[model samples]
Target: MAIRNMTVATRSLDADMTVDEFKEWLRRFDTDRDGRISREELRRAMRAIRARFTGWRSRQGISYADADGDGYIDDSEVDGLIEFAQKNLGLKIVAY
Candidate 1:
């Protein structure tokens, strides 16, 4: 039997905060006040928050959160981002 090493991918949030807190964090990036985060906006936000977003990573993030396939992340899609942060990224986020 051959053993294989599996590397788990994970990202860490800088702090433990609530869903509302997460929303607030997103708001910082939603500059247009359209209640949606554009890919560019998300990129800026990622830079401000973690300072770690390449073009490809930004697009990937947008695609992950943009559940509607609308090319942007609306308020409805925010929860998905929150979930990703909390689950896949190992961030601690409190529920409302």
Candidate 2:
């Protein structure tokens, strides 16, 4: 397996303080004020990153990484997917 050279913020669900922190970040992603993140939101975010980061990766063969298989990336999904949006989208991640 190739080593992914990326600085993704992923926190273990088992660890303290991280799980909650991630949940908060995820909330920002969901702009509809919906309790869960819908696939549309994920797709939009995915596309936005691609537009800014030329050569950015798309949601090509990955499913679970984006969110729950049902289409929503809920609080429960946060624990496992610690990958950076840039890595997942194959784009340059910007913090600002």
Candidate 3:
């Protein structure tokens, strides 16, 4: 998946959603509207996209993956995350 000439791995989504984009996406996943995205919440949202992604959320430690701990990912890790979200999580927008 290459965006803007950046040869990156492929993921499924309308486009490569960044961690920050994912943060907002997380909000959609949190159907309960709980402000914070739990594993279960992530699972629910991911279920529509892919069942595999749920575990990655837990495996990668969502709480810690945020890096600065600002409750979001805004850097390189987005690539890995995109893979997890697409392959494991099951996103339906961008096709990798």
Candidate 4:
């Protein structure tokens, strides 16, 4: 996927965004392009969203999402991250 210049602070996630769109947006912070989100990448994402305590939040996110204990949010565990984003980060993501 082509990485856009849009940052979460500049182009906030829309409440109506579909799950795929949300994933695409989140991927922007996947700096290594490893097809997985790391704790540091998630910290950057949280920072872009103006979230406080980004380090703590990122750790919590990874803890919640990394169901395989692999230390990364891979495709299979993305849903858990999405739930964390919604409940903790106040992001609105839809399944449709």
Report the number of the highest-lDDT candidate.
Answer: 4
* Model 4 TM-score, all chains together: 0.86
Weakest 10 consecutive residues of candidate 2 by summed lDDT: 1-10
Query: What TM-score fits each model?
Result: 0.72, 0.43, 0.42, 0.86
Global local distance difference test of model 4: 0.84
lDDT of 4 by residue, 1-96 (tens): 322455567656444556887788789899999999999999998888788999999999999999999899999999999999989988777766
Q: Give me the candidate number with maximum TM-score.
A: 4
Candidate 3: tens digits of C-alpha lDDT, residues 11-77: 2445454554554555665656646555565556555555454566654645544445555444434
* Window of ten residues with lowest summed lDDT in model 3: 2-11
Which candidate model has the greater TM-score, 1 or 2? 1
Per-model C-alpha RMSD: 10.3, 9.8, 8.1, 4.0
Instruction: Give residue 6's error in model 4 in angstroms.
Output: 6.4
Model 1 per-residue lDDT tens digits across residues 4-66: 231112123444666775677678778789888898887776665454444666687777888
Return the candidate ranking by TM-score, descending: 4, 1, 2, 3
lDDT of 2 by residue, 27-71 (tens): 666889877666565555444433343223223312545454665
Q: What are the Cα lDDT values of the candidates?
A: 0.66, 0.44, 0.50, 0.84
